[model samples]
Target: MSDYQVFIGGSAGSIAPVITILSSLPADFNLTITIVIHSGTDSKVSISEILANHSALTVIEIIDKEQFNPNTVYVAPSGYHLYVENKHHFSLSVDRKEYYSRPAINVTFSSAAEAFGEYCIAILLSGANEDGAEGLLKVKRHGGITIAQSPKSSQVDIMPQSAIDNRAANKILSPKEIISLLLEYNDLA
Candidate 1:
């Protein structure tokens, strides 16, 4: 987890697991965590604030062209497609929705693979749709490690299952297992 940048994507019943993982990490965790969740346009929920309250790491809704830093948790803003413009900054767009989602998981995950390559670690969690599979595949092809939440552990199995089906995930793990693996990576770092 030293120079690695992690991208997590989820929908439907993913919040609880996200909180669990974030809260379990140390304050000095040395990786950048970027998250994308589908909350829809009509929703006014503040996911960044909610995550911030549950974790020791700093959490913020990503601002357009924001410069990213390690140890911070960045949540993609709703209704915009979040992209890693480069290794240092992020860009946002009102691009046409993919998989009926503006902040599509595929967009960020693919961008992260290009920007970080083998240093990228992407995780696709529970979701009702198939948004993340292709992007996760791209990451794996780029030599990045990709993990999909075990279907048995997901409240909604479609998303992670799609990744598994597409051969995108190098590992399929439960939430608890995911946390442990992350800590293991940190230890190696």
Candidate 2:
């Protein structure tokens, strides 16, 4: 499997299929899944518990100065942008929002693109805006792997379309298949 960090971008219309996929990984899988999702109508939802409930993985709302771990998932908080301090640790800030969004997919992805370089993999799943396009561009420019759910399967098509339009994504598959690909990377690694 590839020794790359996987960054996922998805909508808040509901929890995403990609989340289900990431949560299903085998216990021994050697990877971390950092998800950047749109916050819901209320910022008080217990996303960590909700996601952790069915996942075979651990989930946490990332906070400043926390160490990261493999076989785990970090959910960016509802109103905070999640960022990396080192490849294996996390940081949070409310200093500003990017692309008019806090917990913006673009900000997190762009940082991962630069921090991990070729060791990063970015996936844009179901969502409504072009928020992830610039971030995915950063990934592509830095030689990171990029994936987008096929717009046909996306509940909302704009995000994936934007990535495709800019040639920022490397693969465009349905959410179900992304799990296998991520597992394949884990197996190879």
Q: After superposition, how far is residue 53 of candidate 2 from its true place, in Å?
A: 1.2
Cα lDDT tens digits for candidate 1, 69-128: 877999999989999999999999999999999799999999999999999999999999
Please give the TM-score that candidate 1 achieves against the real structure.
Answer: 0.97
Q: What is the C-alpha lDDT of each candidate?
A: 0.93, 0.81
The weakest ten consecutive residues by lDDT in model 2 span 11-20
Candidate achieving the largest lDDT? 1
Q: Find the number of clashing residue pairs for candidate 2.
A: 4
Tens-place lDDT per residue, model 2, 23-55, is 578777777888888866465656776788767
- Candidate 2 regions exceeding 4 Å error are 41-43
Residue 152, candidate 2: Cα error in Å is 0.7
